[model samples]
Target: MGNLSRKKKKNKKEKQKEKTKNNLIDLQMDQENEKIQKTIKIITLGTGESGKSTFLKQLSILYSTGFEESSRELYASTIQKNLIHYIKILLRAAHSLGIKMQEENIRLSRSFFAFDDLTTQSLQAIIQLWSDPGLKEAYERRSEFQLPDMSKYFLDDAERIGKSDYLPTDQDILNCRIPTTGVNELNIVVDDLPWVVVDVGGQRSERRKWIHHFDGVTLVVYVVALSEYDQRLFEDQTVNRMLESLDLFAKTINNECFENKNCVVLFNKDDIFRKKIKEIPLKTCFPNFTGENDYQSTCKFIQEKFDKIGRNKKRVIFYHFTCATDTESMRAVFDVVSSTILQNQLNVGGYL
Candidate 1:
């Protein structure tokens, strides 16, 4: 009986030691997890020029100090270069389409390629060409070719931007066109949580790099150019831009890596979409789209399309109609987004 009692006591002591070891291991794991969660990883995905970069810039303007004077000047130079390129694209498209430019405007178009800088003469010429009916027609057919959504915005401000002492405004910086080549990241602290926002190139060729950034991604901000409903992809003109974005969103959410991760879809460029629906019907891309050619109806229709893609997913998806260039609007929108992210993180961490 004494020997049996000793054996039982030894077993109980060993079990207690084992239990203490497990508790320490779990405590260490929780600490490591807390450290990992300290920095929230956010990934932005969408088709090229869907305002992904613009959204990042907005976050900087809202959360951090905005662009410095030197940065604004750099963007001014880029804007000038982009303006020249914009007109050149229009001119090329008009020529290819056999759209007749006025004889004087034709001369102006040819001269555009030679002058890299936007001078007073060039700015005047740009204004003159913008008035040309042929270029205007090319602008209308912009979807068939590659054109930045901000082409008109920059073109309209050509004279102001060409001034000798001109500096790019916040809006100009927001609307500037610079293709994200690889992965671009923004580190900012929102509501005391460190956030690392990863923006990858949304072009077909650049999408392959996205998977490398998928690890530890807490949230996905999938931007979609709402105005692109009638547009075609830059890489392949046969593919509708909106459809490409939809296909990408489908794959992104269904990817095993992104399973159960919350996603926020920003139906970006609402300003353009609201105006575009009046001119181009959404049915041009989605033929089965029976919704009226109105802003609310079309937006709902597009949201539903994305919603249908994510309906079966266990994760929550939120949608917002965003005009990325509008600072105040985006700030308000991101406020809600950041709060949702915080709550979702807390719930997932079992802190709720």
Candidate 2:
């Protein structure tokens, strides 16, 4: 009887100990997980067609934001690719059957990943505000989310603010401007992962304003348009100014700039550039960079020249990209960006 009683107690003790160990493990796991939430805050920055939106959507769905789980957006790249493949088949099938098609209109959106809704409103309202002629010109010169001329825009509001004839419309954005501004930070993230995203990824020249919002970030993606290589837009002299911005961006954010972690390149319109190269004569980052050394017949040659000399200068591992990139190509490039997060973080802020 004594022996049986002892064995029962021993078994009970063992079971209790097992339960305690399991509980401890669960607690430890909960703590370990928050490390990712606290340590990393990824931000997206790029020019258009570089796939920032698609990639961001992927991330959002993967992580399962606004849904109780990991990204309720419910997407798998391969599945999406397959669906698109079938859609292409359908499109072709319809075309063969003498079916006419209508143009599909698209809408765009970005997030700020912040606490208040101000970031979202800031992006949307500022875009609306910049519609003013003079403000738009200033924004083109310096791409920022700064408030527009309230005097010109909110003439009545200025009067309500106890100020009459305030031609210097916005007192807020003007206040933020400072002389010692070699570096700018436009950090718009929340909980180190960004709950919202309000990005201005188009217009390579305006990419300069990117640094203005870089105080806090965990990841960055740069999108250089290969389409710009194949198709030249010479009517408005916008390309020249854009080239200037690219050169300056390259100069400031050197190779050593991004500590090699959480940064990647989306070479947009890569396929299109290949098909459209005839239109683009100058393939270099800056066409009028006035380099007596480098030639600009092709992108490969330009990258090669920059590679040899860019070694002494800022390195351009910037991938070639296209929104219309094939499945195989996107797979390769997407992996490249994902792996970059494992490298070192880039210098996402300041002039350099």
Give lDDT tens digits, candidate 1, residues 172-229: 9999978899888888888887788899998889989988999988888999999898
Candidate 1 has an lDDT of 0.87
Instruction: Give TM-scores for every candidate, taking all chains together and pairing residue i with residue i.
Output: 0.87, 0.39
lDDT of each: 0.87, 0.39
Backbone clash numbers for all candidates listed: 0, 38
> What TM-score does prediction 2 earn?
0.39
RMSD of each: 7.0, 19.1
Q: What is candidate 2's lDDT per residue for 45-75, written digit by digit as tens?
A: 5443344454444443344331222221122
Q: Which RMSD does model 2 reach against the true structure? A: 19.1
- At residue 218, candidate 2 shows an lDDT of 48
In TM-score terms, candidate 1 sits at: 0.87
Best by TM-score: 1
